[model samples]
Target: MKKLRYVKDEGMNKKRWLRGGVAICLSAAVLSGCATGQDKQGSQKDLANSLKVMYSGSEDYFYQEFGMLFSAVYPNIELEVVNTLSLENTLLDQYNQDMNKALDAFIEQEQPDVVLLDPTTITSLIENGKLYNLDTYVAEESYNVGGFNPGLHDYMKDIGGGQVYAIPSTFRSQALFYNKDLFDQYGVPYPTDQMTWDEIVALANHFPTDGAPSDRIYGLEMAWSKELTEVVNVLATAEGLNYFNSDTMQMSIDTPAWESIVEQSNQVLTSDAIFYYDYIYSGDYEASSESSLGDPFLEGRLAMKLESNYYIDTIEIAQNNAQDPEDIVQQWDMVTAPVGLQNPDSTGYSMFYNLFAINAASTNKEAAWTFISYITGDEFARVQSKQSYGNIPLRAQYFDKGDGRNYAAFYKLKPINNVPAYHQVPQRFVYEFPSMLQQEFASISDGQLTIEHALSELQIKGNELLATEIMSQEELKLYLQEQQDVLGPGVITR
Candidate 1:
């Protein structure tokens, strides 16, 4: 019975964030051999156990394909899969409710052995104790926690209260993808993994300003206009900018970290070197188009762009299906994404992570761990990495293969500790606050507001929103009472 901490407010249940930074102890568990489950090496009978799995994202391809792979490995073990629907899209209210009901009913009736959920749904599942704590099995088998991306292991620990509730099976992080052919033509040295945004911007302007009449070309393209939130997030996260004060709960945008991000953003906004991709929804990601505003790299219009591993399949598809394969991405390569001025570990931006966990109330706990261990093993990672499933395997070595080429550097960069509220608030406020402040950002970009005015406006408005969000018990009561007083006894005469 671990002491699990949770947010007290019912509406804000999504705020399952860890307060104060804590070093990962699971790594210690791995070394100390401190786990407690029966280390049962299994036979065909153990392998014959039937397991239920819930896949939160993907419907048609991922599950159907993985089912075959899992079957080939353990011929006797049966996998029953149910998809609650993809979480990649903006969750609609009715859809959210329906999916919630389906999952709730599934868990209640089926009592699944394993659950494959995304980060967005894990919070709710964790609160309900649908996922099991994996400490015992991990310790008993000496499961190496250090094998995972550093920050993600920390995140799992925080989510599970010093235990392991979920493991990230797939992940995709932003990287600095460059065109070697373009760089060669310009005689500009390839971008280094450690280069800063400021440094990259300088390099982007090095190529010829003039180009062919039909398609435009640029030295570098961050596509920041499409991923503005990520752009802002990476820069601010590097400086460890938590949006609000823990004691006061007041939002503070006055920090030097925020200032640095704004300055960097302004540099990009002013440079005209970036390509502003369209903001079409995520569902249209695979559809054919002119690389959308979000992907100048894919259309061969730009030398470089910062993007996630998901882009690899898209580029491969474009190359394989194109009339000419050599021209697509034209000798493309990637390096670790640039770190911010504050945290120089070369980590920032976002990564789409897929999670796996044993159901907390499962009947076949031991056999379930057996299945969980095998599928998440390095061999499975290797197999899955080469597939067209679009999931980037967690282990780096899986990307080590291929024609002396593509994805050689995939594992070189590490995942960042995504600061949930970076400001000690919930993600809704963090995302919303940034969006609201976009007006000021636009003001700065459009030259309507000076940097000073923009900063002041962002601070003032951001604080007001934060105040509303973090209202104290007393504050809430007073506010409600004030509203009641305004109504003045219901006006019976009316």
Candidate 2:
């Protein structure tokens, strides 16, 4: 029985790993190989008669449901989808061991026509030449690109090198979730879309300590994970510091922006307004004054938490599980992150989303492209919006069309305001910048390193990584030239 359990767990793990890996690998292999059925003498219809689509298991339902709609529009095509749902632990282990092999093997075997992938994963895969170029298809087809925010479209190009490699299906931005019940208890105004960081701090400071010194409420709870590093980047950029210059491939850390972040963090830490997790070693929040964001916020302990729009589903789940569901509903609400000086009244941030791309080497390129179009286009967006997919629709028109309950709730949630300057950085930079900033910033916040020491060390370590892991200037120039050749001239503007 023990052996049986181990075998079952192992099998489940393998299934999960294969789901993400196989889809990725198949998509990569298609970029390298010739289109399916091209060598066999046949008409366009014959070439597209049957095709296989490899997609992540998480996306299986979307493919099946929306896929039927696509077929209804064009019956000549047949899509056979393969689902792989690999365990997270297995993928992490593989990632540590170079991260490309399992995916490569899957691509070499299944040869799927279309694939959906996380944007960061796609960026790394693209760097290794594992995907197709979609320039020709995008140019020829009259896609409703106009509906997308121009900044987002431009950011996609910077990552895809003007090839339109993938279609942005959904997007997420970070926001501040506050407990309305706590505000009422403290007689504080609810945070607004236009609140500034200073204002947030002031609001946090107003919580009455009362006669008992130990009974103080914490103003904020921070997650401090690598994911929140984007918050740091946005804040830095808003303070007028450029962390990365994609044009010159230089990293600058010794700026006013960095200084501002360190100072602000210190203020938040030292202030009576907030109590961080590290402040209390006692894990029991009920026995202590401090709490982590998730626990405290859900239990009505903390006043505010910085979270992504994706947290809405989790919030809803927690609310459902509450002893009094009505109490949960009355307690929580989300607002955009505090505005910075540069973007005063606006949220300074960046976003990434899951996207669908066609296999460049598929024997059925046209059919695959058609399927991709249908999946990412208006019809699929509407259906996806209705399903509570923790995502906002990419198409502007679909925002108002879905069911009043789900879609309307999402619409009431504000769209994050972002600047063109914030969106211009390459996708690779966006992924790496956050973690690097977090590591260095955490050291400073923990008092393990001083501000100057942190900045200097960050520069040294960052340069070393850039020199070793990232392509050099000469290599990038050559790559850009090659991409221009495949995509035709003027696709990438300097």
Name the best candidate (by lDDT): 1
The models' CA-based lDDT, in order, is: 0.58, 0.55
Which is the leading candidate under TM-score?
Answer: 1
Candidate 1: C-alpha RMSD to true structure equals 13.3
TM-score of 1: 0.67
Could you tell me which 10 consecutive residues in candidate 1 have the lowest summed lDDT? 14-23
Off by over 4 Å in 1: 1-42, 57-62, 82-110, 117-131, 139-155, 158-162, 211-216, 224-252, 278-301, 350-352, 406-408, 419-435, 446-453, 463-494
Instruction: Show model 2 residue runs off by greater than 4 Å.
Output: 1-47, 52-76, 80-112, 115-151, 157-165, 184-187, 209-216, 225-251, 275-281, 287-294, 326-331, 343-350, 359-363, 396-450, 461-494
Candidate 2 lDDT for residue 401:
43
**Each model's total of backbone clashes:** 9, 14
For model 1, the local distance difference test gives 0.58
